[model samples]
Structure formats: C-alpha cells, structure tokens
Target: MRLVAAAVTFGAVLATLSGCGSDGPSGPVDAGGAQGRRAPGVTALPATDPTLIPDVGERLQRRIPADTGQVLVVYGEGENSPDSTAVFYMKEGPEWQRVARWAAHNGRKGWTVEHYSGDDRSPVGVFGLTDAGGVLDDPGSRLPYDQDYVAYAPTVNAVAYDHVFDYVIAIDYNRLPGTVPHNPTRPLGEDRGGGIWLHLDHGDGTSGCVSLPKGAMKFLLRTLDPAQHPVMVMGDERELRA
Candidate 1:
C-alpha cells in the first residue's frame, strides 16, 4: 500500500510540475512587510549574534508572546516564493540568541493569513509548537512522539514524501494540542486549514508546510523543549518585521 501510494504521489507531483494543472500553489507574488509592529517591553538587541540573517530578532521581539522563550523563525524570501530559512532561537538574559540555522522551504505560493486546505500557501503569524511524530523511532524528543505510518502518510509526491516524516514537529495551527500530531481532527473546520508542520525536506517545495533537511529535523526534535513554551514565528521577511 505504501508503495502504491508513493507511485501515485510521484506521478501527481511530476504532472503538477509539468503544468498539468492540479490546483497547486500558484498565487500572486508576495508583497511582504504587511505586518510589523515591535511589541512592548522588548529592548536591547542581542550582544552575540550567531547567524547572519538580518532583522529577525527585532521582528520577533514584536511578534512573539512575552512568555515564549523558544522560537523557530521560518523566514521566507518572499510571499510567493518556495524557498526560506529556518532559525531556532532561545531567549537569553534580555534578547534572543540564535541556536541553529538551516535552509528550508515553504509553500509553493508563499504565505497567507486566510489559508485553506490545498491552497499551497502557508499561514502567517505566530503559532505554538506542540505534538510531534515521525516514521522513525523517537529521537529523545521532549514532546509526545508518534511513530506510526498512519501518522506519517505520504500524501504528496511519494519521492517528496519519502522520509519526509522521518521527523516532524506539528505546528498548532487548527488542531488540538497534546494529541498525536497525525490526528485529523481540525478545530477550525477542514477547509479553514490544518496539519501545518515542520518536517524533513525533499529538496522541493511543499504543498503548504515547512520543510527542512532530515538532519535539521532531527536536531529540532531533540532541541524543542515543551517547558520553554516553543512557538513558530513564520512569514515573509517584511511581514515578519511588521
């Protein structure tokens, strides 16, 4: 059954790439910086910056909740671009510190607040990080982990989905927390969107989820601590600053 699914998905992905028209992510070019406002009480940028990415610390200070100490910023190159950069940060004494960085990919069409299922656009804004699971065994993750094929189905191109679920961090978009990340129960209605996750990259754009290299996925799984109240601040460069 898995093989059959993979075959089907691969063909579909190829056809989509060839412009066969399956309603893939093909939205307008993004006009970033749509949402930026520094939050209160955040001052003094970090003294020691680890990564070369610009303005993310300042933008996150205004976006993330005060209580959030751990953040995964998925900064996209543009609103409609598939490429992005993922950086993990931990709050230091007064500012955030970059712990890790990796090349990542977002939805085919970029980002949108009014995301829907099969829209090919990732949702913008801050969201809490909760449950996680994958096709492989647990990797010392702090959060609950499910290692079932059902939880990690290869719905996309089988090649792309291959090992994509080897590790996954479920973003609390429209689903209930504490449950298995694969739970199909979407709180915001199925159409409103659900199942947005950070998973292993396949070297291609995802339907509407963020993808990182397998190594990075494993690193994230091992590093994300639930006690720190980890959350994701994702969006185009400009909007993230806003």
Candidate 2:
C-alpha cells in the first residue's frame, strides 16, 4: 500500500545560539567538563560565520570527517526532554549553510550513551545516514529505499502508527548500510541498540527514534544525498556542548 503523508504540526524549538562571533571553539574541552559532570547549558556556537558551524565539542566533532557534505544536528532541549531541534546543514565550499531547521520528538526519556532495546532513550553521538524507506514509494532520496508493509508497520494500533513511516531515513547507529534498513543484523549486537531512524512525527515521543513533521521528513529524504556523506550529530543540549 502506498503511504500517504500526514498533516501534523509540531511545537517550535528555541535555540540558545551564541550568535555571530569568532571561529569554532578554541581548544578541546570535555563535553560538559569532567566525566559525568554536565555543562550548564547548550554552548552557543558561531553559526553566523557559516564557515564555522557551532562545534559540538572535541570528542563529538572529532568523529565527523572534514569532507562530510551533509549533517543533521538533533539537539534535545534537556537531558530528558521529549522535544528537540533537527537542523539540516550542507557544506558549501569552505563553510556549512543551514538549509532548514525543524522541531522534533525524541525518545520519551531523552538521551543516553548506553542505549539498549526498549530503552525509551535516544543514543547520544554522531552516526551516519545511510538508508531510507517507508510504506510509500521512493521520494527521490539518494539513499536506498526499502518499501514493505512489515518494514514500516507498528505493533500498536494504526492511530499511533499512522504516517509514522511514510518517510524514514535510517540513522546508521548500529546497522549497516548498502543493505535493507530492516535487515536487523545490528553490528552492535542488537542489545547495544539499533533501528534508529528519522521518521514522520506521530505527535508524541518515540521509543528510540527521532520523529520530524512529515514535510520535514520529506525534505530530509529529498535533500540528504548519500554521495555527500551525510551524518547526524545528536545529543542533549549540555551533552552536546560537553
């Protein structure tokens, strides 16, 4: 069955950006300082320069390659907020440009490094965007698309699952790319976490996936070019700066 996009409006996201100034963060600072310690809040990075997208900190930023062309940054409002902002950026020449920003719903409990199945917490860190799929046909996404009933089905009622997978961009957290998104062969051994994706919002928190409005999901699918080496940087505001 062809999936139809849903009409859902999400709340707005407030960003505490530091505004235009300087280059990237100076030296390496621990994410939120020493281990286990949390930063006061989100570190406003200078997105004004365009040349410098706010640095998510040394530990996290180091994982991203300089040549990566596309990045989706998901910033949760707090350590346990169900809401967050997902911004899409494209590397143009020497700098990155903010294409679009949308509000999103993350795991109900927020984020965690030790992610496990049914954790209700999204994993924190950078991961690749390598696949796309849904109940609908291909939406011109660069990533391989997998269209199947069970592939996008929700065990719950249709109301909770409706349009949830009309569009989905697989976040390569523990699964492999170049294969179907529903492969379920998680390299992280399934227990460490898997099946994380950027999907259509259902007006509520997800089990462990990130949900954006249907329009934003469509925009992401059409814009996230696999050849550009897309990746997602995700974490809580403080954990991001930390």
Tens digit per residue, CA lDDT, model 2, 23-52:
211111221111232222323444445555
Deviation from native of the Cα of residue 16 in model 1, angstroms? 41
| Residues 78-106 of candidate 1: C-alpha lDDT, one tens digit per residue | 88888787766665544555555566789
Off by over 4 Å in 2: 1-45
- The runs of at least 3 residues in candidate 1 whose Cα sits more than 4 Å from the true structure, single-residue gaps closed, are 1-63
Candidate 1: 10-residue stretch with minimal lDDT: 26-35
Candidate 1 steric clashes: 6
Candidate lDDT scores, in order, read: 0.69, 0.69
